[model samples]
Target: MTRGKWVAGAVLSAAILVALVVAGVRIWDVHQMTSDWALWPKEVPSKVQFANRDYQCGANPMPNTHSLDGLTKQGKTAGGADIYSAAPGTQSGTATWIVIKTGQATYTCDLMGGP
Candidate 1:
């Protein structure tokens, strides 16, 4: 092959390689974003990078009873359910909240104006 032909082939190969790399990165990013898109009750926290935006857990209050049954305070994700917490007994204004999760989905309670 002539010198000119060899240079042209090298440039073309380099361009194709770059294009493939860029395309691969884009495809991987899209897949990651959409994989968690279908999660229930979408409320991702600020620290999470998988989401496009940060969200504060709304105040979803529990029912009349403060059921602390069979749950540890400051529990781990291993609970496989919503974690519950509340202020001391019978206090007029105590923050009662639940950190609920199912599968990979997790979110804080959106209690109605109760801190």
Candidate 2:
């Protein structure tokens, strides 16, 4: 191959390698986070953030209002649990949630923000 063509090929290969490395690292980090969620502290938290959408509860059933994942501000539920939206100006994201109870007063936020 010509010298100029060889140089171009080398540069392109390097760029692709770098991009792959970045993507792999991100996927690994997410996997680690998801695995660690099983050990999530069972405490009433003011705010919750979980990378995995599914919250594991063998026999425990999540509340109906808490199951929906979306934006909410001053949102009220039939169970009388007050909720607030995480980001006010963003559109709703598609994800499911299962409320896992911690203690007497802690809120178990599943899959991110709520409706």
Candidate 3:
């Protein structure tokens, strides 16, 4: 190919490589964010008096997420005491529901600017 064409091809290849790298990095970051326990808050609903329905009836098994890769379930800690969101873009502030030992659900969310 001509010198000009070769240079253009090289630039295009470099651009494509850069784009791929950026995409991969972003994916990795998202994975880490969702799996991070520090980002998750404590007090997740562990036990509740469901007057209407059971929390374990496929409703409170755990926080689930639907992403491009498909449904991703939250992972429990090594102790298997609590669960957390494993997929990013699932919740607004925190991942799924936190295991709250005691608290008023409607009182206020410190992170969501509640009372």
Candidate 4:
């Protein structure tokens, strides 16, 4: 192969490698953020009723209202708890009332507003 062509191929390969590394790092971050809540038992109910309102696990969307990964990234931490909005940002009345107990391997949801 021509020297110039070989150099071009090397540059393209390096670019692809950089892209893959960036993608992998992002995926790893997301995985680490959600791993705590994602492994909760499916048979166990994560729902909680507080103030006559129903609040479910915020990790998964199918059975919950918000993504845990999104919550962890965007939520605020206070008094050993991670507080997040009950609903997604697009929705109105998204109260930052959902609290998750932190500093443990697994998190427990406390809709009652306690850490």
Measured by lDDT, the strongest candidate is 4
Task: Assess the local accuracy of residue 79 in candidate 3 as a C-alpha lDDT between 0 and 100.
Answer: 22
lDDT of 4 at 26: 65
lDDT of 1 at 25: 74
Q: Rank the candidates by TM-score, best first.
A: 4, 2, 3, 1
Q: Which stretches of candidate 4 lie over 4 Å from their true place?
A: 36-59, 62-115
TM-score of 2: 0.37
Query: Could you tell me the lDDT of residue 36 within candidate 4?
Result: 25
- CA error at residue 65 for candidate 4, angstroms: 9.9
- Per residue, candidate 2 scores C-alpha lDDT tens digits across 21-95 of 987776555445333332232232223334323333222334333432554443432233444444434645633
Give me the displacement of residue 109 in model 1, in angstroms: 18
Q: lDDT by residue for model 3 over 75-106, one digit each (tens)?
A: 33222333322256754544322231222321
The candidate that wins on TM-score is 4
Worst 10 residues of 1 by lDDT: 46-55
lDDT of 3 at 34: 31
TM-score per prediction, in order, is 0.33, 0.37, 0.34, 0.39
- Candidate 1: residue 8 lDDT (0-100): 100
Worst-scoring 10-residue span by lDDT in model 4: 36-45
Candidate 1 structure quality by residue, lDDT tens digits, 53-89:
2223433422344345543444332223444444346
Candidate 2: list runs displaced more than 4 Å.
Answer: 35-63, 66-115
Worst 10 residues of 3 by lDDT: 106-115
Per-residue lDDT of model 4, residues 1-115, tens digit only = 9999999999999999999898777655544443323322232224434334444554442323334643433342322344444345554553434544344433435443432
Residue 105 displacement (Å), model 3:
14
